[model samples]
Structures are given as C-alpha cells and as structure tokens.
Target: MPHSQDTTPIVLTIAGSDSGGGAGIQADIKAISATGSYACSVITAITSQNTHGVSAIHPVPLEHIESQLDAVFSDLNIVAVKIGMLADADIIQLVARKLRQYTPKFLVIDPVMVATSGDLLLQQSAISTLKQELIPMADLLTPNLPEGAALVGKPVPQSEEEMGALIADLRALGAHSVLLKGGHLEQDANSNDLLIQPHSSELLRAKRHPTVNTHGTGCTLSSAIASYLAQGNRLHKAVYLGKQYISQAIAHADELSVGGGHGPVHHFFNGHVNVR
Candidate 1:
C-alpha cells in the first residue's frame, strides 16, 4: 500500500524521546499528525520509561541538538513548533538559541516539569533558564496545575478566582498567552481550563472522565493546539478545538489496554467511522 502525497502544514516538535511511545516527542508527533499537520521531530533527551514510571534519562548532546534543528528548519516549511521536556539547563539554553534563530510563526511551549507518575523530568537547576529564555519566546504556554504553580512560584489555587490570578501572574512572566490547565485541580464532575490572552480570558468547561489512562494529556493538548495554529486557526479557537479533541481522547481511552499502569489515550480514535 502507498500513501498519498498530500500537502499539509509542517509542525516541528523539539522535545524528549519517550521509549514508552506515550508522551514527550512521541505524544507530540501523534497529536500533531492526528490534527492534520505534518510532524517533524528533534529529540532532546531519551528516557527509559513506560506506563509505570521513568527510570532514567539521557540528554542529547548540544551539538546533536543544534544539528537536528538546523536540519529541520533548513528544509521544512515549519508553520509551528511544540516544545516538551528538555532535561537540563544546557539543553534548555540550546533550544532557546535555536528557537531564536528559526523563529517559527507559532510556538507552543509545554513546560514539562513532572511526569504523570510523579517523577521529575526537568532538572531543578534548569527551571531558571526555562523561565528566563524559552518561556518568553512561546506564543502559547500550556502548563498543568502543578507546572503552572511552579512557573508562577505559588501554590496551586483551589478556586476560580485564585486560578485567574495565577494566569495573570504567569503572563507577567512574558508568555504571550497562557492555557492554565485545571485538570489537576481537585477532580470533580467537570474539568475547567483557563485561557488568558493579552486582553481577554476564557474558562473552558468539559466533562471529566474517570480513567487512569491519562499519561500524556498535556503533551497531546499542546501539540493539538500547535497543529490547529499551523492550520491557520486563531489562538482562542485553537485552544477550544484542542480542548475538545483531548476530552474525547480521554473519554475513549478505555477502549485500549496497552500497559499495566496509566496507559495512553487512543490517538487514532477518530480515524475510523466506528471505533469499537
């Protein structure tokens, strides 16, 4: 069988490798392609991980990282970029430098600090470099509750007013826009996410699904947003559509049994007429 040579917007993911095929660069590529963008990748770090947890990490050398970025930006007409886990200060600095050089039209930064299994992905010392350099370059910052709190140097809020305040504080850190994910906020019947732009704010509401197969929700959402942006959708609209896509993914994650703990969402759920 052969595939069609269709022309689609290119989206580059500069992120870490997930041996589990569930998160990091793996999830970014899946979400980007599933949302209609051609996906390219630059591996930042390789992690020994799976459904249970991450055991070890090996950061790619700075020279290799630079080479990969040059290779992609030189040839592909990249419409957008999605960045995930960069394990250390050196890697973060390297990524920030490359981003400044290429300057893609849209950049979605997912500050991947902690993995779903409560393992630390980013080094503590790299937080400063990430905040000072990479975050300000992002057109959109997608951080879950804990990551958002870490970014703002505050505790996770327990109320809507508190969440709104957090968004403002994060935007003050220089990101053009912020999607403060509320999924980690005491789970209830519904999940609420906040999107803050320069002059407006929106609280996106969706029904929360009960499942443990949410290993890569943040990566998926941010990559989907980048894909939508590459397809020419506006920021707010892209965020909304990305939310809808992730909700359905989480809702239907039970259809597959890939691993023993915290399995991945079924990224190909919409590829068929009947997903049974």
Candidate 2:
C-alpha cells in the first residue's frame, strides 16, 4: 500500500518480513500503528521464519526495495523512518543513499542481526556496510547486547557502566545517538536499557518486567521510538515513552499465546481486541 496520511504523523518502516509475524516489519507496523502514527512500509526481504527459527530468506531485489521507497517518498508526509533488516550490503548501500537523498525528520535504526532463534540474518560483509553507510544517517540506533559486542569487536558487556561506555563508542563510530539494549544482560530481576550520546554524561535508563514471551521487543522498540519522534517527542523522551510501551507490552505478553517457543509480545496490550 502507498503511504497515506489523515492528520496523523506518518512513519515508514524499511525492513524484512517475518512469516511468523513476531519480528521485523510486521512488528514494526503494528507498533507504529498502535502508537497512533500512520504506517508506511518498504520491505527489504522476506523470510520463511517461525517461532523455532528462520527456515529460509529471500532478499527483495534492490530495485524493488527502491521502488517501494519511491512509492512512499513521492506522496507521503513521512515524518520518521525506522530501518530494520537489510539482507545484504548492496541493499544497505542503496537504502543509505536513498535515505540521504530524501532525508526524513527522524531516522531510527534497529540493527537486526542474529534472530531470537540464533539464526544470523545479516551477512558478515554487510556489517561493514551497516556501520559505514547506515549508522551515520541515524538519529538513533538500537542494538542488542550481542549486536553491540559484534559491532564494537568486543565481548558482551557485563556491567551497565560498560554498556554505557560502549554506547558512547558506537556514537563516536557513527550513530548520532544510541540505545544499547540490555536484554541479554542479566541483573537481579529487572530488564534494563541504557541510552546515551557521544560525549554526554546523562544516561537514559528504562526497565521492564522479566517475561518469557518477549520476542519482537527490539523491533517493537525502534518502531515505537520512531512513532513517538514522528509525533514530536524529543529523542530522549521518545525513547523513554517507548520504554513504557514495551514494558506494558512485555507485561501483558501472555494474554495471547501466538507461538510455542519465544512467543510474540502483545502489541495490542493496550486492550485493543484482535479482529482475526
């Protein structure tokens, strides 16, 4: 569908499709729409995915992705862009170039690499393209602990302070601001997230209840942040409110069971009834 608006902030998601509807563009679209922003989409790839794992991946041709972007950019009041999975380096480069040419007000990236099922969705070479081309364009970049470790060429951090320093390092590397997700970090009982910017002393912190059904949390977060930013929240405030939304999302995850292993978070946790 082409991008359309009706006095709502229009947010676009450029990402892959999850057949299981837990992660990637599916989660992004739901999250953005739930946050009261109109959603426009440009899919980068399609994955034969399930709750257990990724069975296969078919990349959308670079030109096809570009055409989708063109369809949206030509006629929408696009306020923000959230990037998720780009299947390869070439696609990454193309997306980076197009985004630079048609700059949106807010550019938020969720650097999706390894899936919750332990499958690597991004190529080894594509990491370089992501770092070199994409991160520089982002107003905010969100990466999980494993992604952070890989991007910085270091071990997964054990301390919040270490994560803070790593966030700073990644900001220096490219992202104007960074949210280093602490999902993989184990602390007492709270799930934590740390947000910081280059040379900044202030640390933005958020917490959520620990839950088993936590799939799509990252995608949900980046999309939520983008939606909030599109609606005129400052970056840090957007992140903060996004955190609250995800916390409730996690807390209410078990209201509906969608999968056997690593079920999806309840995007309709705000009491919206599922129609289908």
Candidate 3:
C-alpha cells in the first residue's frame, strides 16, 4: 500500500538541547509525541547537564540556527511552534525575525529562565530582548511563577491571592494569553495555574504530586499545549488538556528512577508498563 499524503499535525520546537534528556528539546519532543503530534526541532544551544543541574552551555552560532529555521519552516506544514530556551539576545532577535516571516498558526512561548535544578539556562541580559521581541508574538505564553515575576519586575507571589493580583501585570506583557504556573508555591497543596486571557481568567487546579522527579515539567507542559493546539483544539481547551497531561505525568514520575537528584516526569506514562 502506497500512502499519498500524511495528515498528522506537525509541531515545531525551537529550544536548546538538554543532554540529560529530561528537559529542553528532548522533553518537548517527548511531550509532543506523547500528546499525539509529529515533532520537529531547531536547537539554539546545547547544555552539559544531568538530573542534578546544568554544568555548561554552548550556544549555536546564529547563521546555523537561521539555516535550521529556514529548512524546517520551508518544508514542514507546521501548525504550532513551541519555543523554549534561547541563550542570549542575538538568538532571541533572530528567532523573533524568523517567526515574523513564517508565522505559524499557533505559537507557545515557555519563558524558561531558571531550570528546576536552579541553573540559569537563559542569560540575564537576554531577558529584555525576549520581552520586547518574542513575548508579544506568542499566542500563548507559559511562565512559571519566578519567570512571571521577572517579566513584570515584581516579587514572586506567595499565595493564590498574590498570584491573582499579578494577573493584570502579566497580561500587560502583550501575549494573547498567559499560563502562570504556581508549582513554585510548594506550601500550597494544589498546583494551581492561572490562565489569563484578554477578557477572562480561569484557575486550573491539580493535586501537587509529592516527588522530587519534577525536572522538565515546565517544558513538558508548554509542549503539550502546543501539541493540542496543533490538533485544532481551541486555546482554552488545549490549555486544560495540557494541564491534565502534565498532572498525570507528575503523578507517575516516581515510577522512574533515572538519576540521583531531581528526575524527569513520565512523558509516556500511558504507553508501556515500567517493569522493575
């Protein structure tokens, strides 16, 4: 049997590579595939990392990055793009330019700054460029509590009430929608994320899974959202579905023992049984 065409939704992920396989481009691909989307990637940087922390980062040259972007955008029928880590200002500007040129149907930006293991994946100087160039172009911006606070120059919200108070400021950053992750509020029993759009808001609540294997959670979540969007789900519904996916992934994290430190979520938790 000869197939004439493939109809799978193609989702592109532009991010750095995580040698650990728990986060960055690796995690994005896993999440997208697990969520039923074909995944493509363009690596901006590569990190020497593990479940413990990032040891070193080697950013790809700008021209090569541009070539990768052109190759993917020109060929693939990309429906949604999930952007993760860009190491510096130059990379951010180039990506922003390419995005303007190609303009995929849906764009999910995970403003990844600090990693779960307390490593700085993005440069402090690049923050301004990211804010000015990439953020406004996002169809959905997914930022953890610390990233949200950095975007708005405010303190990390201590409680849900404080998270509510920062919604207005977050919206002002110019993304069409924002998913403010509240997992950093470890004191809270529930992992709450606020979905703030132009005229409405919703609090997405999930049980906080008790485990240290939470590496790449943010990357997995944003990629899952992009995967859903590529599958033609509306933004609100896609976000909810993404939340559900991550929650389950977290719930099953303890099932894997990848490393000695913070480990990764089970991106394919629904697939095969983990035999001991």
Q: Indicate which candidate wins on lDDT.
A: 3
Local accuracy of candidate 3 as per-residue lDDT tens digits, 19-86 = 99999999999999999899999999999999999999999999999999999999989999999999
TM-score of each: 0.95, 0.94, 0.97
- Each model's lDDT comes to 0.90, 0.87, 0.95
Among these predictions, the greatest TM-score belongs to: 3
Q: Name the lDDT of candidate 2.
A: 0.87
Residue 22's lDDT in candidate 1 = 86
Model 1 stretches with alpha carbons more than 4 Å out = 1-7, 272-276
Clashing pairs in 1: none
Model 1, span 155-253: residue lDDT tens = 978777788888668879799999999888654578899988988888999999999999999899999999999889999899999999999989989
lDDT of 2 by residue, 1-276 (tens): 543464579999999999999999999999998988889999999999877889999999988999999999999989999999998999999999999889998999999999988899999999988999999888999999889888988888887767766755676668788888887865635567777666564545455566678878899999999999999999889999998898888888888778788888888887776734
Q: After superposition, how far is residue 47 of candidate 3 from its true place, in Å?
A: 0.1
> Which of candidates 2 and 3 reaches a greater lDDT?
3
Which lDDT value does model 3 have at 203? 96
Taking every candidate in turn, the Cα RMSD to the unseen true structure, in Å, is: 2.3, 2.6, 1.5
